[model samples]
Target: MKYSLVASLILQGSLVLGTRDLQPVHFKAPSALHFRDIVRNDTYDFGCRPIAHPTEDGQFTLHALLTESQIAHLTEEYEDTDLSIHRPSEKRAAAATAPIGSGDRFSGGTIAPIGLGTKASGSTISSILNVKEISSAVQGLVSTYGVTTLNLPYKTFNGATQFAAYVGAGTDKSQYHLYLSAGVHARERGGPDNLIYWISDLLAASKAGSGLTYGKKTYTNAQVKSVLAAGIVFFPLVNPDGVTYDQSSGSLWRKNRNTKSGSSGDSIGVDINRNFDFLWNFKKYFDPSEAPASTSPSSETFYGTAAASEPETKNHVSIYDSFPKIRWFMDIHSAAGDILYSWGDDDDQTTSTTMNFLNSAYDGKRGPVGDSAYKEYIPSVDLTNIKTAATAAVNAMKAVGGRSYITQQAVGLYPTSGASDDYSFSRFWAKSGVNKVYGYTMEFGYSTNFYPTLTEFNQNILDTNAGFMDWALAAISVGLT
Candidate 1:
């Protein structure tokens, strides 16, 4: 069968959020762990201030400008931390302290453009395509190639719908699945764009009757055909309402548009990243100083009333469970230059191929635990083939644009419970069998500003394309193994 008609036959199942208890969980935002301490906090670095409390709108408006000293402090903290895997060369680092000004495209300046499509990459492409443009592009691919495009069965509080594009090489039902999803937090605009660009490149190559190339290696027709035999699913924008609000209103919305009543503010959303069921709101998953879920509904990282309560979270879980064979799952996020693996809730002392290779590449021999609560645990599967694929993905990314993304377990970045990446991996890996899915959160861009200006955003997209491509290719290879 031709590829274009393939996905249309796949079921666009109803949005079935299975029956679950809806008891409201009082998530009190820890007073000690203010907004300043959150790993994903970009308020100071970007032109924004933290609200004293959550508002009717779940996000803070991007209006507060930071002082020179505050900007410097945040920049220093970001640079000095281990989470920052690669730094700009010495020449760029020297200019890090300059007074914030309208930044030039090439110079490592602080000021970034506020809008998208202000700059063009080629005659056909520009920086930062909006949600509409992105969705349209995906549809175009599906129309031309007969690939599957699944509309998420649920709409946001504002009635915004989302979709996922599936690209596969064959019609085999039991083919291994490789999942790539982005835009979980609405403010992180770059995640979906990266996947879109990667998909476009892959589809273009497939159509031209040519093979895809990575670094010095080129996959011939037979290789491409064989590798693509597996299924690749890309959920580009999971939080459409949040992205729309952030782009259109310049608000820093970070959660799905869920208009439920909360404990403190009238804010009506839940942080989708923290709404997953795995380790959901388990106080032990976070440090006393860093309670992962906020008690206040208005706070940024608020996990919802119940695990998987939000429709978006339910959609993600439904997709994962529905897939027959998943060898790799990547929940792409932004503004951090890290490739994080599972066990985000505790210190990772597991002995598996994935852990060994990830720690070796990014952490040397000894994998550093993210917190003191973690004790050594064993993995259910031997991760040799999976580790090989991961090493290739990381190396390929670095080879492209000379931009290196640090690889570590998710907890290495910060202690957070109910994150999607951890949940995705744990579902398979935590099982006592060898049928494991290598799950990850591939964070793009090194800056705190999830929403960068058109020029910078485009540049980051271009620079990271190599890595994304390599990761996709590796995903195909691992599926075959």
Candidate 2:
């Protein structure tokens, strides 16, 4: 009944607040163009008079009421890029030479097809997996390969469950782990689906007695053996209810399904990304007046009632506690084409050498040179690796799909509080002083919000797979000088 009410309201474009009073209330956006996470200053007249607040990047975060026709118009704009259109594959490699002092150029062999349900060209929603399907696929991998499925105890507002897969749990528990998560914002469907494709490729490589290869670098069977021993953990979908809702209603819902105390009015759900406990609403990077995240429940970036208020937020905390061996973490999102490192609140973090390295590397440069700068790393983070592994990953992604993903500090892009990557890094580095786990956030794609068509979606998955693999390698190779 709760689900039906929301869905019905979305279809009707109006909600009743009192007897004989119909309000033109804009609820969660019904399409990608209206995604609440987007920072836009332009206000098209939607009924109920949309409200706007200033955000960074010279844009405004909006909460608006739109009529049914307005939503249709917005959706038509989003569909401008057809999903069914096939995109030609990019050239297999970059120019076959090196530029002196410009940095190491990645040369690589042709990409091998390790099928995880993407076509050589074009994209299709049919290839993507739902929550139940994801669970089944994970179980299949567990049975066929040595992967282990770990279930989280949390359920979404619609009673949907969440789970994860562990690739090396049977090995020594002391081995470090690489943690990757996607689908934190339900409408960003690519991240979760991309993880499945990546996991499938890794499992396939493991089964075939071959190592995974990204660009020119191939992890030989020996390196593969060692990396597998180190462990890989993946959370494919963090907000199942929200994903289900988006796919069903064609709405770009960015938060969890938590609603206002049994009321079906206005917007519901907290932005899970802003609900983490660390530095939550920290005045420097986040104040309700200045940040996209809000104290009100109706906001797309709504911070929950209190820090770590939602089950999803608590579940991530449990994950952090469960894995003391976690050496690298990435919270993947889409449509930005960026590989972001932590200290998300600011570009210059007092404690981060990595932050300093990145700010200098790509501060003013734009386009390819700036995009390649993610490889810059400070030696103090790890004596064994003065070279950052992120550059190789970024380059590999470019080489595969020609998507230029810039690497930088998280705050280099925008101010965020209670970000998962920041919290993950803070858990080990700031609070525990371990400083072993290096955290990251990979914002994939070069398009608008999370509503890419199948063609764009498949390309994004292909483009990002290389970077994901590189990050996994870096996680396992930490502290090796």
In order, candidate lDDTs are 0.55, 0.56
lDDT of 1 at 13: 17
**Per-residue alpha-carbon lDDT of candidate 2 for residues 1-481, written as tens digits (9 for 90 to 100):** 6998878776545323221121122223223224323232112222111223233344433333344555565556546542111111233112121111111111121122233322233333334555555555566666666576767877766777677777754754345477788888876667776787677667676667776554333456565566566677788888777776656554455678788522343356777888887556544333232342456665556678787888888877666566667777788886566676655554342334554322434342211112332222334444223127666567667777454666666654335567787677666435654435666777786432355655566667777777777666665555421
TM-score of 2: 0.68
- Report the Cα lDDT for candidate 1: 0.55
Q: In candidate 1, residue 336 scores what lDDT?
A: 58
Q: What RMSD does model 1 have?
A: 13.7
Q: Model 2: which ten-residue window has the lowest total lDDT? A: 98-107
